[model samples]
Target: MKKPMRLSTVAFFMILAGVAALGVAWWTQHKLGIMPCELCLWERWPWRVLIVLGVMVPVLPARVGRGVLWLCAPVLLVAEGLAICHVGVEWKWWPSPFPACHAAHVVGRTLAERWASMPLMPSKPCDAPTYLIPGLPVSMAVMGGVFACVVFVTLCVGMVRSKKIRRF
Candidate 1:
């Protein structure tokens, strides 16, 4: 039989994964000059929460720590849902909830006024998807959903196995 992973180990891995994902996104934005859409920025919040949970899980009491680890499953599921929604927006299956996804409106009467009010660099449209791997036909949102699902499953299985071992 395979040995079940410790809760601390699971927590550590979750933190690492969260950081790595954010790092890649940052690299893409800063180094590659690829800007994220409003929805893309929204997708990152859950990962930040997960990183906080990961840190707390290792220091809390055993039962509480395990509970924290279990909490990760739902957090990741929500992240995946957000990513899926973003994918839908990208594919034009539905519209984004954020107004920034649409074109910016200039309320100014004069061209100079409009130019002054406009942002230096406009944000990317949410409907336009960015692929980390060129020609892969997979957008960052799709990849995020996949990663979230994988991590969710891992946390679920780990929690279940931990429970079984505790009962024995």
Candidate 2:
């Protein structure tokens, strides 16, 4: 295959790896019926962006696509940082800023009205330790870290390969 085509294939695999990771998270949640906290949703933003970049790199212009791939570095870094912090909070290594993951439960006689007044809440805490892989020492956040590292490595490799191919 041509260099661009090969690079595109690698990009597709990177995105698929991300999707598979998320899928495992979702499947774990489904089987266990666990929900993500508000902060957890926030943790997803970077991965979501990576997923988009993975899809776009193959289809978009080279310059724009390269820029997007480069952009993923910092994004994943921050997200990984947030996930690490979140895991720390869950492990009691630190206190989470958002003490409440889900919305506060309604109280008072007007419970129905209170419920009605409750604001729309996110799926999970941005720092909630919801990863329950039996016998495993790692949480979802840790797994996210692993994925980010893999993606960064893959992106770097792709960049190098593309540069070499361009020169040839």
Candidate 3:
């Protein structure tokens, strides 16, 4: 018989994958000099959820953990979609949000005005790619595709394993 997959083992690998993905994102930003746009940063929130779930599920009971993994499916799918879209936007495949991506300089009349307006304006936009390799045309989002794939694959694997375990 095939060895039963341990919840802890799956969770551990998932967490490790998430961490590695995050590390790659950071490293790509720093080494490649790609700057993240506002939406790019926003998209990361879902990935953060995956990472958290990956670690937390191992601690929960088998039933609860499986449920959590199931829940993670949609979240991972959405995150992947967002990352893919972001990459497309970076490549000009689709129109990005209006007003352009990235922070704009506000010439406020006074220091207080500038401070007050800061709350109203985001530091970055969806159109602007924060980081790009010095010579390469590819943006950070392009590099991030790998991370999305990782999440997608992990979610798929978890689902398959869960089904197999339940059948037994």
Candidate 4:
């Protein structure tokens, strides 16, 4: 084939990857009652960027669109990196880099003072990983890392093959 990538196909895949990641996260949070930690929420930003890129793709010319889509490589890497960091934190390899990931200290002599010092909403700790399946070994963060890696590799292969053709 002269071109392995069609503009529509690129756009569709971009949106698909983003939506799938976000949708799964949302489902686990709302349906399964799994709360996300601060780092987990931070990890979602790259997917959000992908969603925005997908929406912008169809409007651009084919070559320009493909060029823009190339940005996905780094974006995916960022997503994967965040997931891996989250996994490391879950495994206790190291402490979470985000301060928000730590539990707030409620120090006060009086009960009311302590209560007032505590966060209004109870935030999940980054070290506690969320497991979806009952017997599954992998945590959600690890799964997310795998997902990002797969998408990144797929995009790279497809783009590299297209680059060989020297036309977008």
Error of 2 at 155 (Å): 1.8
For each candidate, the alpha-carbon lDDT, in order, equals 0.88, 0.70, 0.68, 0.88
Off by over 4 Å in 2: 1-5, 102-106, 109-128, 165-168
Query: Candidate 4 lDDT, tens digit per residue, 1-168?
Result: 555666567667878999999999999989988888999899899999998887887899878878888988899999999998999999999999999899899899999999999998889999998988889988999999999999998887766655535446
Which whole-number lDDT from 0 to 100 does residue 49 have in model 3?
Answer: 79
- Candidate 4 C-alpha error for residue 162, in Å: 4.1
Cα RMSD (Å) per model? 1.5, 4.0, 4.3, 2.2
User: Model 1 reaches what TM-score against the true structure?
Assistant: 0.93
Q: Mind giving the per-residue lDDT tens digits that candidate 1 earns over 8-87? A: 88898789879977988899899999999999899999899899999998689988998888888888988999999999
By TM-score: ranked, best first:
1, 4, 2, 3
Query: Once superposed on the true structure, which residue ranges of model 4 sit more than 4 Å away at CA?
Result: 1-3, 161-168
Candidate 1 — worst ten consecutive residues by lDDT sum?
159-168
What clash pairs does model 3 have? 34-131, 34-132, 35-130, 35-131, 101-125, 101-127, 101-128, 102-125
Model 2 alpha-carbon miss at residue 63, Å: 2.8
Candidate 3: 10-residue stretch with minimal lDDT: 97-106
State in Å the error of residue 139, model 3. 3.4
